[model samples]
Target: MEIEIFTLCDHAQDFNGKLVIVGTFDSISSSVYPFTHAACSLAGRLRFSEKESGVHEFKIKLIDEEGIELYPAIEGNIDVSKSVANYSTINFAINLGNLEFKKPGKYAIELYIDNEWQKGLPINVIKQ
Candidate 1:
């Protein structure tokens, strides 16, 4: 399997086989200690192995600069049924529910597939 595109955006939607995304960014500023990302979306395209048709696990995590987890890991099972297509679309609305930054620094959004680390999206935070 391979990833074609991955992004963190202000808005994303699947409109009749189309992926629509807006306001893709990596940095945010906050005036409070616990910074809450009120709304955001993660969207990407993935190519899967055609050898089998079954269920696979997809997980995501948010980690702070200190290596501390900002929130609990999010995971779900992806159903790859009998299909002839090799590519699939994925979209997730990530709402961390008022996550505490602890301190201002760089953070990361990690993606995992089948328990294996796939990719990471770097995030920076600044205090206002």
Candidate 2:
């Protein structure tokens, strides 16, 4: 399996196997110690080879710089069916709301597939 695209964005959707992403960003700026981002999305596309067909466990975590989870881990299973082509792709969009940042610092959005770490997306909360 391969990750074709992964990002944090203002909005995202999977429209008939197509990924529509908007306002991709890596940082947030606020003047207060604790800030709440009203809404956002974590979007990605995963490609699976014919040999990888079957059910795969997936998990997403949002952790602070100190390795503390900001929210409960998102877990699910993805069923990949064999296609006529060399690979089959799956698009996903996880809508997040009321993301609270406790301080100005770095955070990580980590992706795990089949109990293996796949990617880490960094985000910074900046104090203005």
TM-score of each: 0.82, 0.98
Stretches of candidate 1 off by over 4 Å are 86-99
lDDT of each: 0.76, 0.96
lDDT of 1 by residue, 1-128 (tens): 77876788877777775778788899888888776677777777666666645788988888987767777788898886656575444444543444567667899988898999999999888998
**Model 2 ranges with Cα > 4 A deviation:** none
Question: What is the C-alpha local distance difference test score of candidate 2?
Answer: 0.96
Kindly list the per-residue Cα lDDT of model 2 for residues 1-128, writing each as its tens digit: 88999999999999998899999999999999789999999999999999999999999999999889999999999999989998999999999999999899999999999999999999999999
Model 2, position 16, has a per-residue lDDT of 90
10 residues in a row with least lDDT, candidate 1: 88-97
